[model samples]
Target: MSANKKNFQVPYTGVTKIQVGKKLGTSRLYIQTPSETYKFKFQFIKLEQVESSIRSFLPSSVLIESGQLD
Candidate 1:
């Protein structure tokens, strides 16, 4: 739900936008912050479940965009 590595963390509050959709026949997740945009490819994983998890962790102020994957 959150991104963490060693001593670095990207808090949910820092997230400005989230986008879920298919690109080039691949399911992708895009998270945007003030200065960065992270892209993740969903392979063999359920995107809806992932989205739900992310939604649960994110603030209501964050914008989430959902697109049809089919």
Candidate 2:
């Protein structure tokens, strides 16, 4: 043990990947950051809405190049 000097308080600057899937009758969104991965679940919204919301948070250049993925 070298005294745990790593800082865990830094904010995520960008999102690297986004994935959407369904499980147990609920829709799930997976957001991959440099330091961590986040998951969100929704039961009412359509898949397109979920994707749009995620893209809204990302940089416009990324969306312009590839658009949203399935």
The whole-model lDDT of each prediction reads 0.76, 0.62
Compute each candidate's TM-score over C-alphas: 0.65, 0.55
What candidate 2 gets wrong by more than 4 Å, as runs, is: 1-13, 63-70
Tell me the lDDT of model 2 at 1: 35
Per-residue alpha-carbon lDDT of model 2 for 1-70, expressed as tens digits? 3467653332334766667766665667876778787667889887667777767866665431223334
Pairs clashing within candidate 2: none
lDDT, model 2, position 38: 68
